[model samples]
Target: MKHQKELYKEAMTVLKATSRTFFIPITFLEKELKTTVGTAYLCMRAIDEIEDDEKLPNTIKAELLHATSQLLLKPFDRNAYLKLLEPYRHQLPEVTLRLSDWLALCPEGIRNTVASSTSEMADGMAKWASKGWHIQTKEDLDEYTYYVAGLVGTMLSDIWLWGAGIKTDRELAIGYGRGLQAVNILRNQSEDKERGVQFIPDGWTRNDLFQYAEENLAKADQYNKSISKRSILMFCKIPLALAHKTLDTMRKGNNKMTRKEVEQTVEEITSE
Candidate 1:
């Protein structure tokens, strides 16, 4: 058998490179797992790249995900999406390079699991983009976030459960994922607006959103504290702070969410 240590090291190298590159704090979590935390991070990182990528038209993005998923059913062809990413090669995270190497060496089972899940995440994204307009209500936002991020919550909970010391508070952990994503949506209101995406409900205006943001931040704090894993806690904390800041700004009638606010939030959380 190939060494588990080697697999883990590759995974963590990818994890470290991906998280820092993407401004995520999730990697501070490696110590809690008995097995491949590295693979988990790499898999999740790839998902993050897709979700955060603002370049492609919605349909193309959906097609790319469909292709990625289909390729995963077989062996992953590294070159398949390599070209798509090449123009922005300098922008690729150091972790993705390590992830490529790790993908080659990973246990078939791990690779299969990660690959399959990535496909599902992509499929869900595709379905969301084209058909989302059919969803004409606030209830739609709940389902949409669940498909995009709440599912990440479930996936993450499963990962933590597979590891040691997870202390699974199933509802609580998933709440962190859902709440965190919601906070990001709230914070990125302007950017999303530019893309013609509206995450919050039409019924909820600025003041109502402020109250909702405050509510979610509190949920994040509660969930992070309820969970035993320090890594999960660290990951949860950033959005909690962002929600906190956004809520505060809303109180002052600061309607615009700027890059400066995001940078300030990032700095504040990392320093802690």
Candidate 2:
């Protein structure tokens, strides 16, 4: 087995490769807190990659997601995951293939919490994948976002309280997650349509989605205000600021922010 330090180093490498938004804030976290949040983020990203794979059939994705959920329900099992993934190793990304390492990176006390959240997300992804990611109502959209993103908020709240010695409202944390996901849906609407997935409800307009994002972002603002730890506060602020900027950019007819704009936003947030 790799040492925890080695696992954390690899996790950070994967994180930087996969998500600049999270990598920025997570890097500033204190040692153990950094490992805990990094572990959770990588684990979630592992399953997310499986859910978003273009080449895999929905049935195969569902099977992999369901099996992953089942594996996470119990204690960590390297052999079981290896056996489960061996058949489609070539089809999956390295993050998904090396899920056992991410899971093992968590400090033991918080490992189960991270695993359980990831399991729930995987189970949710499996359901949506099996259903062809159908979205025809506001409720349906909410459920889907909750599974994929809102639970992320809940998990982070748990981590904040556990590692940072700060507590926050679980509901507001969920709003933070949903708000970010809604912005993503907005920014990716064209790409998603090209891929035959529609996050917009049947009759909803762009304005409606914007409204949804704004409402949740309001809650996210509240969630950020509730954080007392400066590091955790800054951690939450950078993403929230970026999400707001991205949403505004999309409103102004841009697909997404430029790399320069993203860096400026991060700079502004960190400098404050």
Top model by TM-score, which number?
A: 2
C-alpha lDDT score of every prediction, in listed order: 0.59, 0.91
Which sections of candidate 1 miss by over 4 Å? 1-27, 31-39, 73-113, 132-135, 215-218, 229-242, 253-272
User: Which regions of candidate 2 deviate over 4 angstroms?
Assistant: none
lDDT for each residue of candidate 2 in 23-47, tens digit (9 for 90 to 100): 9998778888998998899899999
Model 1 alpha-carbon miss at residue 190, Å: 1.7
RMSD to the hidden true structure, all candidates? 5.2, 0.9
Put down candidate 1 lDDT per residue, 42-158, tens digits, no spaces. Answer: 665564565456665667656655655576667767786676556555654655433355555544545566566556766766677656324446577666666666666666556
TM-score against native, each model: 0.68, 0.98
By summed lDDT, the worst window of 10 consecutive residues in model 2 runs over: 3-12
Total clashing pairs in model 1: 1
Model 2 global lDDT (CA atoms, 0 to 1): 0.91
TM-score of 1: 0.68
